[model samples]
Target: MSEITPDLVRHLGVLARIQLSDEEVERLTGQLDAIVDNIAKVSEVATPEVAATSHPIPLSNVFRSDVPGDMLSLDEVLQNAPDAADGRFRVTAILGEEQ
Candidate 1:
């Protein structure tokens, strides 16, 4: 098993652009090491004969019928909007332009 050292944790933190203290790195390294060991144990028991199952129950295409029905008009759809402009709902610009 690959050892998760403080240096490895520090490198990961740098890649993710996160600031972490030495104490945090030590704590995280121990936790990550245990988790990796646990996953290794689980992988050892997995066999090719058994089909991989994501959930406890078998799931298939659970879908609803796509039947067209009477729909609301454009005006009716936008009627409940607090601020509507043209034919759609108006929202504030996320990026402010420089004056």
Candidate 2:
């Protein structure tokens, strides 16, 4: 079991630039010890035969093929716009300021 003392917690708090109270230090010491113990248990079960992965299940790309075909012309695209100027969509000036 990992031994996390109050002194160790206090020193860690200083290093992290955190101001921990006596009660907080005492509480964190036990919590930190438990976390370290759990990690140690996991390490014990991990073997060279087992592979490390970010996810439990295998993943594959689910995207369609990138094929470019049939694009609309500038006139066809601007035909549906409410307002257009200089071959571009015209929008109201934001921030209540004059353009």
Candidate 3:
């Protein structure tokens, strides 16, 4: 009941521009057949009534609640900075880009 044949494997090798050895082609044919059989088994287990989903269980957000709190003054923020320019933090130019 193997769906993949050595001839099909050889054809695929040619299409992919690969020079597979005779043993490799035989091995790939068997492996591909097993993969196809497994897929068929999986499809059989899946029912139309069962909705497709990304996860097995329901997921909830693991982040803190977004509650707006405090606003820091520009001078307060610039006080601890190594350098400040035009009311903003000054950083070194990177990747040949102008600062």
Candidate 4:
């Protein structure tokens, strides 16, 4: 079993830029020790034959086929625009720049 010392916890807190109280450090030591122990157990069970995976079940891309379709004309698209110029939609300059 791996042991988590108070000094190690204090170092981790300093590296993470967190101010941890003495009580918090003591409490976190036990929690981190338990976590490390559990990870060690998992490592014991994991073998070279067992492939590492991110998920328990298999996954595949679920995407539709990319087929070209008829597109709207410029006139049909610009009909609803509040402002249009040069066959395109025009809006007020947000950055106070001339169009």
Task: Tell me the tens digit of each residue's lDDT in model 3 across 55-96.
Answer: 999999999989999989999999999999999999987756
Ranking by TM-score: 2, 4, 3, 1
RMSD of each: 6.4, 2.6, 2.8, 2.3
Clashes within 3 Å, all models in order: 0, 0, 0, 0
After best superposition, candidate 2 residue 14: deviation in angstroms?
A: 0.2
Q: Which residue pairs in candidate 3 collide?
A: none
Q: Which TM-score value belongs to model 1?
A: 0.59
Taken over the whole model, the C-alpha lDDT of each candidate is 0.91, 0.92, 0.93, 0.93
Clashing pairs in 2: none
Residue 20 of model 1: what lDDT? Answer: 94
Looking at model 3, residue 43 earns an lDDT score of: 97
Instruction: Give one digit per residue, the lDDT tens place, for model 2 in 47-84.
Output: 89888889999999999899998999999999999999
- Report the C-alpha lDDT of model 4 over 48-88, residue by residue, as the tens digit: 99899999999999998999899999999999999999998
Candidate 3 ranges with C-alpha deviation above 4 Å: 63-67, 93-99
Give the C-alpha miss distance for residue 33 in model 1, angstroms: 0.5
